[model samples]
Target: MLAHNQDSLKRTPLYSLHVSLGGKMVPFAGYDMPVQYPAGVLKEHLHARAAAGLFDVSHMGQIALRPKSGKLADAARALERLVPQDIVAIAEGRQRYAQFTNADGGILDDLMVANFGDHLFLVVNAACKDADEAHLRANLSGECIIEQLADRALIALQGPKAEAVLGKLCAEAPAMKFMDAGPHEIAGIKCFVSRSGYTGEDGFEISVPAGDAERLARMLLDNPDVLPIGLGARDSLRLEAGLCLYGHDIDTATTPVEAALEWSVQKSRRSGGARAGGFPGAETILAHFDGGASRRRVGLRAEGRAPVREGALLFADSAGGEPIGKVTSGGFGPSLSAPVAMGYVPTNLSALGTKLFAEVRGQRLAVQVAAMPFVKNTYKR
Candidate 1:
């Protein structure tokens, strides 16, 4: 359904390359993205796990924030008013995965908040870019300059062999640890490289000027250890790793606590009480933590071949008739060779092995709320 408008959508910086390589273009987040190459989703997914896979993620929003006062800590503190993370303490060259939460404490968007010392670099969902930037501008106090990097290109190299591939281009890449980022020169081109990714594997996300993106992509593709992956495979990969997709598994209606993301709130931010907490929905979020939430995000597995998809009704085995929850993300995993999903169920039925039912196509499929990462994550810590 999301691909219905693919024909008229704009393409990314590597559009020509994707077309040249036989990409199956589809509409995703308002942009025409390659859902898979001629190799298809299954092979692309497998390639990324066994070797390195490159991704074109230029459609996502990139912004640089610099406070008029030129103080990075002050800017971070200002940002803290709208999000739950302890931004003040994030070291330079370090990256933190966080969220932009609404006044009700429900996530507006999940984002990567990176401290670039002199400025802050933010990467947010492409579909939510306008709203996210507007929200930041409305909330940030005083003089802060926000520069959108709409002309930049993003590429992710992920898999067990990722380091080997990147190391050959940037000798220092292999030495980078998880969540760490720095400026680097790769193949004579200056770029930003971070040791992180969404696929639950060892990886690096490279940000480069839009003009040089195609060249860099070609270079990476030429490596025997690397292949170009697409959005379809990216979806399956992140799902298998138990990561949440912004608009689906998480949204403005779901609180962080209910979303199983309490770790994003640091200990000090809680101990210091109300004044210490400045983000939207602080009261609701803190209350949920103290008393626990009514429902929680969990993994679900169907008993048979049919794939349970988003919006499928979830029923408790004990309480038969009415729906107790809904699936947010579900599909057949290429690697696991089975169906897997992430959803929210009432707290009482949110444990491993908790029997449930997914009503798909008028048939009640046997389902169970299972532990996440239906496949174990191989992230290099």
Candidate 2:
């Protein structure tokens, strides 16, 4: 990490391309990037669901882990000590979403791990990249070689037509199912393509050399179904899909079980398995799974037009009874045509159909605990 002038934010390789495409620039994660294009956030979001949208995500960190023993299982075993998930089970050319947790079971950062044929590839959050690299080095360097892929750029192509659009460029892209990653050549440039994205739609996340990012982006944008999207739409899309936005829905204060993410923890890592309870904070996280967490993360549906926002207080009654919980990620869902949010509330009040009220701007707004994904996920199987 290096000191930087607040006014002089960093820019990605696609800065000039975004500017040329009428992008609205803003500061995000220490980078001056596009928040939206001329078509606006709402349209950008809908376009991704209807057709296809290309997004610049080069701000995220990409790292490679190579095992000195030449055993891929060694790399996976090394990561299990820091996170709760079963990384060793991820087959070749597939991806697994996981988090780096601290000793207290609090998530340090959420990341995506891909098992390429010979080594493991990781894509960590942009803001936590430095710290994540440090943590990996301090804990697993003796078992595996860690290399940061800083010269690469990441872009996501999402929507119903994403497969058709990318398939036209690389014949092998559409062959990949959800969470699959494979190497391919697009526009005569080599890249690693993954059939996954933050958006809940079927899509591909392409990682290419930073020097060739703009060219590849331009080629994809030339398609009739493809349009450039920005961060504003990216947020709304992920929210409607009920995906957590790191620092918001999850943080150092939250654990996998409390966040309703036990599904990500492999069965082998839980109690009763032969190799269970070896990861950090195993006692705290495992206990919650058996005894139930005191508080749970849940999805809320706003009863009115007002969008419930993060930090809003939750009450069990409209009369503003004692606060029960608080909103973590709240926003208007473009696809749902209603406000959707996720929050933390007492376990007894987390079941679907429970009535609740969110305090917005001093006014209590009625809400209901609802099933997540405010919209359905359209990922390619």
lDDT of each: 0.87, 0.92
Which predicted model would earn the best TM-score?
Answer: 2
Each prediction's TM-score against the native? 0.96, 0.97
Scored by lDDT, model 1 comes in at: 0.87
Stretches of candidate 2 above 4 Å error? 1-7
**Predictions: Cα RMSD each:** 2.2, 1.9
Give Cα distance to truth, residue 120, candidate 1, Å: 1.0
Q: Mind giving the per-residue lDDT tens digits that candidate 1 earns over 86-150?
A: 88888999888888877887999989988888988898988899999998888784767888888
lDDT of 1 at 103: 81
TM-score result, candidate 2: 0.97
